[model samples]
Target: MNFKEHIRVIEDFPQQGIRFKDITTLLKNGQMYKAAIDELREKVKHLEIDLIAGPEARGFVVGAPLAYALDVGFIPIRKSGKLPGETIEADYNLEYGKDKLAMHKDAILPGQKVLIADDLLATGGTIQTSIDLIKQLGGEVIGSAFMIELMSLNGRDKLPSELEIITLMQY
Candidate 1:
């Protein structure tokens, strides 16, 4: 569906030499957004997924709808302190510093199969932290999905070698 064409690239966004791939342009278009969800759904439907997990913000944008399409629960992986109740967290080392992400302790039952989703795979820090949190809670990460991936970063190398990845577009 040429999902990449719908992505907005802002050069030097958020910082110098950083090209941000914005999905808002694609989200605003109902057809492409639906197609993206449908495609993601198709990619993971064959798997035995008990829940769809995603990081905060952008992940919510793509993960929630896909969760609905799959008829599975959506588990939000949020920044530290964003979630109430007992939670588990993993800290990731960012380019400048460290960032922490958390998810509810009971969000996943032991042995539940989870599929992580996100808007893009950049450095893989966010999702890798998310995967750690999920595994810490005993949820097996069946696979990971993304709307777009920045290949130059080699983010996949940071992820678990056995984990499957699905991305609609790469930049």
Candidate 2:
């Protein structure tokens, strides 16, 4: 689908020497956005996923549509305190520092299979933490999907060897 053409690479965004691949350019185009989700959905459809778990805000953008397309529930893994009721949390390291993500204590049930989705995969900290949170609740992480992956960061290497990550484009 020539997905890379839809992406915009901004030099030194939010920091120096960082080339950020912005998906908003692609997201603004309905055809491109749908194509991305369709591709991601197709990749994960064969997996036994009872729910789609999206991390934070961007994840919602990608994961919600996938969950809808697959007729599965979408669970949002948000920043700490964003979700009401009892919650479980995981702390993960980022390039500069650390951050925490949380999910409702009951968001995932024992033995439930979850597919994690996000807009991009950089260092894999976010998705890895999402996997930990899901597993803490007894949910099995079956697979993961992303619209873009920053391969230079070697993010895929940080993920568990058993996981299959499907990305629409890489840079």
Candidate 3:
């Protein structure tokens, strides 16, 4: 679908010397949005996923629809204190600051297969922390998927070797 073409590259966004790949441009277009979800769905069709877990905000945009397409339950890995129940939390470092992610305490069943989805894979800290939260709750991370990945960041190196990662576009 040439998803990369739909992404807007902004120079020095929110900081200096950083080029941000924005997906909102593609997200706002219905055709491109549908194509993206379809592509992501096709890539993970072979995986035996019991749940689709997405990080907060943007992750929810792609994750929820992907879960429906795959006919699996959706789990939300949200920012700290966002979940309205007993929750599990993980703290991690971001490029500018530290942040935490939380999930419902009973979100995943023991030994359930989970596929983590997010809009972009940057430093891998957020996704990696989500993976840890899923494991701590006894779920097995089958793979991780994203619409875009910043390859230069080398985020994949921080993840488990056995975990499969699929991305539609790389920048």
TM-scores of all candidate predictions against the true structure: 0.96, 0.97, 0.97
User: Which 10 consecutive positions of candidate 2 have the poorest summed lDDT?
Assistant: 90-99
- C-alpha lDDT of candidate 1 relative to the true structure: 0.91
lDDT of 3 by residue, 41-112 (tens): 999999999999999988999899999999999999999988889999999976546899999999999999
TM for candidate 3 is 0.97
RMSD of every prediction:
1.1, 0.9, 0.9
Query: Across residues 1-171, which tens digit of lDDT does each residue of candidate 1 receive?
Result: 788889999988777888988999999999999999999999989989999998998999899999999999999999899998898878897533588999999899999999999998988898888988999999999999999989998898889899999999998
| Residue pairs in clash, model 3 | none
**Lowest summed-lDDT stretch of 10 residues in model 3?**
90-99
Candidates' C-alpha lDDT:
0.91, 0.92, 0.93
Mark the 10 consecutive residues where model 1 has the least summed lDDT: 89-98
Give the candidates in order of lDDT, highest first: 3, 2, 1
Q: How should the candidates be ordered by TM-score, best one leading?
A: 3, 2, 1
Off by over 4 Å in 3: none
RMSD of 2: 0.9
Residue ranges of candidate 2 with Cα displaced over 4 Å: none
Clashes of 3: 0
| Tens digit per residue, CA lDDT, model 2, 65-125 | 9999999999999999899889999999865468899999989889999999999999999
